[model samples]
Target chain A: MNKPPTIVIIDYGCGNLFSIQRALTELDVPSTISRNPDEIAKADKIILPGVGAFGKGMENIRRFGLLEVLGAFVASGRPVLGICLGMQLLMRASHEFGYHEGLHWIPGQVTKLRPGQPGEETVKIPHVGWSPVNFNSNNDGLFHRLQNGTYMYFLHSYFVTTENPMCGIATTTYGNNVFCSACCKENIVGVQFHPEISGPSGLRLLQNFVFLK
Target chain B: MKNRRIIARLDIKGPNLVKGIQFDGNRALGLSEDFAYLYYQEGADEMIFYDTVASLYRRNNLIEFVTAVSKHIFVPLTVSGGIRNVEDVQKILRAGADKVAINTAAIANTSLIKISAEAFGSQCVLAGIEAKRKENGDYEAWVDYGREPTGVNVVEWAQRVVDFGAGEILLTSIDREGTGNGYDLELTARVAQSVPVPVIASGGAGRKSHVLDVIHEGRADAVAVASMFHYYYAKPLQRMYSSTNADGLRLGAQIDEGNLEFLNARYGGILERRFDPISVKGLKSFLAGSGIQCRNM
Candidate 1:
């Protein structure tokens, strides 16, 4: 059998890099953290883990000169997963602190999660906790190995609403709003929840991502 | 709009977890990591590590413990106590904590809440408020782990934090803590009503009904439990392990080392009935059965 491919974690200087490394180490998957474009270019897979606002995250990414490098990475078609803010940065734009442009890989907009919407109940902002997700059992995606309504840890004040409905692999309901929890289109996958902090089911999801070609 | 959270709060005194009543009479439990690992397996929604004396001692000592548990436990862990500034919050986050709950520092400098939120995001900042009920039937905000009164109204303080940049609130009732009398519903309700963020009700959780009351009546978004969940969990593990960790330090080294044994001998029979050691899975089912809305594992 071929040796398991090594994964490269990009240090954008915003996410929980240590926890992500710990999770991967526990999984026995060899990985390395690098800011060098050359190192990121040579990796088989990339995980963009970020935690913070859309505006600040974009500023840091631009400063590190990773904007163009990351664009080529997604274009290469190797598996790429964006977590939380990392996922939000994949969208077309975000309405966070102010108007901010995203990587635009995923055709969507990032908006603050408020209590009242047209048909939505007044759920609190910054929805924090563990909630069950709605996954299509037949899709065989990152969450395919798990149950249909498996619970995953979620903590966010903003959510991704994709223009193409088919891109959302799994959905979750908060109050009257049924927003996308996990987004997948080809090799690119994004999740609003943190799998690193999510537990066994979360590990299974990461394993599924790891096994992807 | 979101699933109500069932959070397990562990108050630590150095390595071993200590239990106390209203912040007094603290008795040591075993290794903090062991209990944390168990709670995660049992399906806790989230966990809070509140160091009872880290501020008094002028040091944050949970870095090693947080790093140990973050390896396998994949759930949101909120670290409170001795969070003096933004740098302290950053170091704690780097140590594997998902969120930092600020009380003393936030009260001392309200801008700490806003600046931290701007730096990290609303979801990453949690304002922990310790409140005590006054004779006039009003809630007053207390600081220094409820040892000092801030002369600030509980509801007003909660609103101030939200306006300043707190994404969530962890409200603990000083008088009701560890009394098994139930949460201070009125106080929780007032704070929850005033804030746009999620409010976690802490202190005085005796039964599942107490949780329900606070959620529905108090409008709390989450319920935090300690004795109700930790009491039955640690006693058995204490007997099973002699040494607390790889270190040579023997288990049960605290001044009140025999509290667990004494409680077991004197009130073990009714302890389960009083606090009701409901397993994580069982508690979810009980909540669903009671027609209360909660996420199932």
Candidate 2:
């Protein structure tokens, strides 16, 4: 068996890093949390995890000078998984609290997950809880090692709507709306759910990400 | 469409799991970590680690328990009690709690909700509202585990909490809690209807139908229970289930009188057979039987 390459979790100062790190450790895949450009760029795979606002997340990434290395790293065709806000930050823009620019790595616009009339604040926003993720194609990359209809926990109000519709490879429903839950554009992938906190299915998803060539 | 959530709300007193009727009597159930794992395994949608008396004691002590459980349990965990400021929220979240349920402190300092929500996203802050019905047929919000009354109408407070940036409302009725009288469906409906965010109907749930009442009629996004989860088959207040079959869970593989001690030493107490004593698994299957969508099944 070949030794697993060094997996780096990009610590941009905000994320559920501990849980993710603990999950990786349980999978017997020792990983490192790094903000250094060189360490991040040199890793075998990268996991961009964030837990807060898209603008603030982007601000931190730019502040840490990780914005460029991240794009360059994914351009190298190595696997990169963005979780929740991390995935949102991969989009071109977000409508949260005015307008904010994303990494533009994935061609999409981040918007609130709602289904009522426009400006009706009555609809539930942050769609919290566990829901199933249905893939557009057969059990392939990202859905690797997992069966269909497996449930993963989600904790966010906003979702990504890709301009490049082909970018969305997976989908989940909230209310009457079906939006992009996971997007895979070549080596770049983003999931608007927390795999680290999604239990065994999530751990399996992380494991699949680890072995993804 | 999203499925309704079934949350196992475990009360903690200094890192130990305890259960009480209407926030009064404190009886030990088991170690926090053990029951957390057990409940999560038996099909709880989520878990709440509420420090039952964090105010009287002055600080939160379940950080280590949250850390231990989060490492193993993949579902979201909400920590309540003694969280007064953003730093406390940060502390709990850093310790691996996914959300912080603020009650007393949120009443003391309303800005804590906005600040914590801004810092850690609104999704991480749950407005823990303990409400008691008043003489005027209106409900007032209480804090410090129903010790202090805010004199705020439950419906009004629920809306205010959301506007103040609470991602969800954990509405617990003091009147029905631990009584097995079933949740205060009226109270739950009022608050849930008033709030834009998700509302978790809690307290007064003795049977599975009570959960249905709150979720279907009250429009609560989730249901939280304590006593329903503490006992099994109307057992006595001392027997604790440790195995998947609800066998007495061992403390250290210790056997006493040919039976494994179910987490003995002031731990593991069952509630009286007030209502139907069913396991989390039973609750899930019951809900599923009624065509309700639940995880792990």
Candidate 3:
């Protein structure tokens, strides 16, 4: 029998590391929280949990010299999960608290959610609470066992718009057909919602991630 | 076009619900169980439980309280205080809280708003902004339970929090908190205009007219009152019931007498026949015995 993979949650002065750790722990998956580049580099899987402004969060990663380390880890073909702001940091850049660069692991930019058509009621930023995620990819390992139109909890203002549509494994609806959620290239999955907070369905999603190839 | 929200704030201190003025004139009111049950029966859109001691002790017991309260009510429950990370947010949500409010942590990190909002969903993340009118004629954001000044402009911070993915902004005026002079209309209007998320006005609600003023003039999506409701110092029910005359008429219809009678009988008459102010301390003690933590403000 093979041993379960070790998961490492990044702790770079972002929000809520313990909650994710607790979720992983509940699944009997061994995990550790670390801000050190060395620890992240050696992990079997890396989970990036973030909260706050995108630019500042990215700056913290750069300041701690975790960018190169993260880039190398992704290059190594191990699974990397970016949650919320962590997902946003995976984009090329964001216009939060001023134009700032992201890690650029995924090819995209983070932009605010706005009303799609003219004269449409502003769809309001920070699309909070529980909303459904429409899974677009059946073969995507990140969401392999998840069903389409599954409801997950979401809380985000900015979303990623990729030049490569194939990178988006799922999408959710807000005011119009704009991107409410997404996942990326295999081994690099970014979810706009917090599965850890989405009740039973979210817990199952995290379980799938822990056991994914 | 969003509906207005009527929120009741429960401040827990040890095993009692306390109310005070200027965030200091503290006093025990009633058991949390009775108060929460009563408010839910009265059609409160939401409930906010602030663990005033969590930060001081560096641990959150509000989750347990929320879980206990959830068993008795069907409305959304928001728990706050001492929520420092995503794990804390997740635990609170799992424990039955519909939303987690982040205050001091947000001022210290700001990014927590985005991270929590992203991980949990924006609707589950609430950014609490404590503001005070400074001598400089501008509102400033305060942290450390409204003890320290961030020196950040209230309007700018509100917009930034929205950008950071905060689903709602809970704005409390420190100056007007216990004064019941009415909401800080100018401050609230400034924030509501600057950000696109729903803004909840807090502090200084002395009458039902104040709730109306905050909703109309302040342009707030909701109003959170503590002292007025907790101490029975004002007629919250009358105000809630009277709002039916408003043009928008967002308040929920009054519960029918038949339904009230059924509830009264079902709950063994613990529920009062009318909506009146109750003791915060008494309510907290009742809930504490039932495994809920009530923090008095």
lDDT of each: 0.82, 0.82, 0.71
lDDT per residue (tens digit) for residues B70-178 in model 2: 8778788999999988889999998988899998888889999999988887888999999999999999998898788887888887888888899999989999888
Q: Which of 1 and 3 is the better model by lDDT? A: 1
Complex DockQ per candidate: 0.72, 0.63, 0.08
lDDT of 3: 0.71
Tell me the deviation in Å of residue B120 in model 1: 2.2
After TM-score superposition, the amount by which residue B235's alpha carbon in candidate 3 deviates from its true location, in angstroms, is: 26
Ranking by DockQ: 1, 2, 3
Which candidate tops TM-score? Answer: 1
lDDT of 2 by residue, A39-129 (tens): 9989999999988788889889999998889889988999999999989988999999999998988888998876566654233667878
Using TM-score, rank the candidates from best to worst: 1, 2, 3
Model 1 segments more than 4 A misplaced = A117-120, B235-273
Question: What's the CA error at residue B25 for candidate 1, in Å?
Answer: 0.7
Lowest summed-lDDT stretch of 10 residues in model 3 chain A? Answer: A121-130
Clashes of each: 4, 5, 41
Tens-digit lDDT string for candidate 1 (B186-273): 9999999888888999999888789889888998899999887776675455344434332311244442456545443423344645
Q: Estimated TM-score per prediction?
A: 0.92, 0.91, 0.56
Candidate 3 segments exceeding 4 Å error: A97-99, A115-118, A144-147, B1-48, B52-167, B171-195, B200-297
- Indicate the TM-score of model 1: 0.92
Evaluation by TM-score, superior candidate among 1 and 3: 1
